[model samples]
Target: MNIIETNLNFGNLTKRSRTVRAILHHSAGSKASAEDIHRWHLANGWAGAGYHFLVRKDGSVYRLRPEWAVGAHASGSNSDSIGICFEGNFMTESMPTAQKQAGKELVAWVKKKYGFTKVQAHRDVQATGCPGTNFPFAEIANGSTGTVTPTPPTSGNTYTVQKGDTLTAIAKKYNTTVDALAKASGITDPNKIHVGQTIVIKGAAEKPKPTKPNGNTGTNPIIRDGQIHARNFAMPGLGADGIRGPRTKEAGIRVLQQAMNRDYGAGLALDGIWGRKSEKALGRHTVRRGEKQYMVTALQILLMLKGYYCNGVDGHFGAGCEKAVRQYQADHGLTVDGIAGYNTFKSLIQ
Candidate 1:
């Protein structure tokens, strides 16, 4: 329940007109850290991490962006809403018990702070599959202050279909049979029920017992030690040791740069040097001549990903890079400045 201040360098904050709603989102990636997300947002030309708060699987809530500033989570709701993102791809995995509790507590905290009543999923505001289907919207919406329990029968006696919901699943949830549901709701085509479709349950079932807490919950390998192990595996010649000395550190970075080029087609030089070219390639910023950074290399890779014919991920902001930028800008209806600025980077990352 403790909120850890990340002290992230978010630069100047943009004042929000008002806070009306709280938006929930998932990272869509497992074992993500606040620093990792901050760097990703920075690469995308955002001032800092997009979410006002980030909750980890271990129930650790990190204050990322300031609550008073406009966030960049939902497309159109940033100005009036607070964004709360949790780690894990809920699309493919159920939220762990700790994360679930933490999310509810965080929502409650936001409610108290902003005096907001509505909590919405990311997909509720946009066309993207963010926050994912497995997100526990009902548990959050009803101000449930405890761990996830079996949802009791609604007083209204109607159930709405959600994404990834199946008739069999609904029947199981309501302690009834699909045939009974079909008969009660006159659902001739049980499979045709779409999201938001209402179906009536004949009668309320007995409340089920609360499930036991999972002992292995919140055990993410990537956050534990897998990332270091993977890095070691990637540079086997470095003895797979987790030491970062001056000699081994640069070599490891070189190996990573090469790996990005080989795996993601980053087109970085095979040289074992962490220069501006490598920085630009990593989506840090657009590089200019006499300035080498990893962001330039990232730009080149993004251009290549979009089918713009960049010669290589060389980390140089040259004529070819400018041309590619201009082409991308024109295609995306951005100002054709032949430079990758905030808008350009946003579009590229998106």
Candidate 2:
């Protein structure tokens, strides 16, 4: 649940708007990072990366655009919703387990923070197969509730090992003892199993009794040794699809204004409009070879926080700053372009 904050400065501040729903999108590309997506958006004449957050394949979360600023994601709904994009083309590949878990956790956090009651795929609002059909909507929706019903084990007698799996962990997941599992699998050493190795489990024909809704059947839900599953009680207004659309949008302009004033001391009036004074106070300038600005100072601070040594947090984007930016981008799997454009700015700020 570690969130890296990229303090991205949108040069031209769009009027603060309220968010009423959370939209899910797939990168539609393979193995790209948040910085890569940000660069692409900039090339398209966008302020920066459109999504408020980006979830990496390994379940790491990176903040792209701030929630208060209007995003450039969904065409007409950008002003009234938050966008979250996952890294991968779901049309041809299933979401990896880590990514799925991270996505669900992020969606749940957004719902709690913004009081958003609706969740939809990109195609649900527009006409495109962005978040492909292979996207597990049901599983993600169910995950938002903070509980998941474990699927019953298959009738097969053998299980293949996956990455990061071990005999002890697998045995615990299947509700069996490690010694028994090793004995059944004919392994001379319990720790000798390798990835993709098939291990046999005894009693392949025995099925655990089913549990009744009221717990009156005397049988409990099958529990894996170290896994926990809790029954999900239905909540009012949330349908079986786990969406409650058409909620009223709350006025959040004041929230944004207050935050700006406190953080940057933008000297803006309490008025919520994105007027000339407010825009000037929150103006963003590009940091390059000879540029100097308070925004660059902020970027330096963030870069240092991310463990990239930038020499000093001065208001200048010089050779040192450029070197730090390049290193950060490379470490995060972004293209090694050294200019502090939209993508670089977003990553540095976060």
Candidate 3:
């Protein structure tokens, strides 16, 4: 497998630290490569890249950290769990072919070496929509959400920009109008995006029904299973029914830690159970400014632009932003919704 891992050590972890389990999957929202993921960790003051290993869409694997070293990727579980970040946003889109191949191989090897019992997506632990929409959650989670298939994608689609890529060039290649591209990508300031920046691309008209599953629907709701199994030449069969079981729930809980971008499970404990802490992180807990630290990223930025504090775009959700959301809802007589619920989010979008 084409993978790279960093050797940096954090506070109490060292080469002696035994990796009990691994949490696999992608950078779901951004278009960053494995190398980019490594760089991002360094830029963010981490000891090094957070994941034990990261696979790029092109099939190149980079190791940001090793199993021996603790990762900062999954909030409360970082100390013990080794994290894996695959390139691409699988939540709302499909992943590259190469990435899918590498993911499986890596997982198999990890399972063999670590004797891991559970493997899953970020959303399995908590209530956040992460790992992206295109993730094959059932295959990875060991089951499906229900018998029902998910909603189909609409005609307008979004795409994140890649390195050495351009909007106009992509527009031309896709045979689409720049206006449609801009709107679909939700680029109010199209000119502001940078290398490795993602944008929406108007794809062929979406089908009326959910597309046939082809490895994108795994235990993680956002990150696809195809990429997760790409590590080895021989990918294991996940089974036909593809329904979620106990294993899938476990993965969601792990991902929940990352989705919430939590340092420690404030309202919850580190145990595998998904309860109040997960709910609060899912934006169900009470809101109070100067209490929550808002993490800055596209999601947080979008929330802030819509008048939520999001603590000045730092990429970590702080208490201030949570307070702002509650205050805004109360002022608007919108049920005093402390959480950034769908309705509140829609209002912010408006």
Candidate 4:
């Protein structure tokens, strides 16, 4: 969450009158630094580095434009929105964990500082598919992406560099590598550790996967009971054979249709078909935790189809359902708030 100041000067910049939301975007190309962006934007005959902040692939945040200045990133919303750009093209590439984590922290910090909750993709206000389809918008927007493991106690996990203690010796004592220690401690030179410098001693932690009902640790499978529940939603082609397969996965549409009919008073028949009626009936209802409704059932079914099981396809948004939703969101690059809303529904159903 550190914002690195830049010495690059811009020609002409206007101070913004208000700040509303954060508009997220990707550079649409790989390997560009803040200086590069500033030069490119200057070449575009405008202010330097149209974005307010540029987050690098190595989790470094650089201040591109002054926070109070209006940016030229977005179309018409530049006057009221702060633009934050990432350093990679998200359309064809997945974001690195460090970059994603840094983006999440930057977005959360900006939201807290500006007292705003609205986080929009570049395409949300423009006609282009910006920020890319592969960007983890949901996780970053909701600030739901987390560290793999809890940070250990400082006394146990950190070491104060003694006058005679070398990084190799400290790493050996901590059972880690010099490279990992250097990366964690932001040490540029392995041979450079002065006295009184405290270094964190930990390895890279991997994200934990949700445990399935069958005691597996990888992708959660759609249980036969989920298929059975889908069959109850009047899903055609399901023979109630207690077997989960492709047909069972497709039956999620029926679950959504049934939920809409029961919960939203949509007059469509529960034929388990995705059509105009189902699409139109899906209002802007964002379902989150602490709710007991048919929409939750639909969300559970959709998630289960995607190999993320939520304990059961029950109409409850409990911890399991939330976790499943977050995992699904992380996979699909959606907002990771564990809430099923218009975008989540569209991504699931469509």
Candidate 3 runs further than 4 Å off = 2-16, 140-350
Candidate 3 vs 4: which has more TM-score = 4
For candidate 2, give the lDDT of residue 24: 91
Of 2 and 4, the candidate ranking higher by TM-score: 4
lDDT of 1: 0.64
lDDT tens digits, residue span 1-350, model 2: 33444546555647445778888999999887878888888888898898888988876677887655788888988888889999999999899987898788778767656667788888988999978888887676546744321111122335777888898887765556778776555455788766645565432213332334663221111211001100111111221211111110001222233434655777656443546664465456345667676555555544543334455656687867766666566445454444555566544323
Candidate 3 has its poorest 10 consecutive residues by lDDT at 146-155
lDDT of model 3 at residue 117?
59
lDDT measured at residue 71 in model 3 versus the true structure, 0 to 100: 77
Q: Write the per-residue lDDT of candidate 3 for residues 299-333, one digit (tens) a residue.
A: 34334322234344454445555545554554344
Local error of candidate 3 at residue 219 (angstroms): 48
Q: Which candidate achieves the best TM-score against the true structure?
A: 4
TM-score: model 4 vs. ground truth = 0.44
Error of 4 at 11 (Å): 1.3
Q: How well does candidate 2 score on lDDT at residue 9? A: 57
- The root-mean-square deviation over C-alpha atoms between each candidate and the true structure, in angstroms, is 21.2, 21.7, 22.6, 17.1
Model 2 / residue 305 / CA error / Å: 20
Which model is ahead, 1 or 3, in terms of TM-score?
A: 1
Q: Which of candidates 1 and 4 is the stronger one according to TM-score?
A: 4
lDDT of 3: 0.48
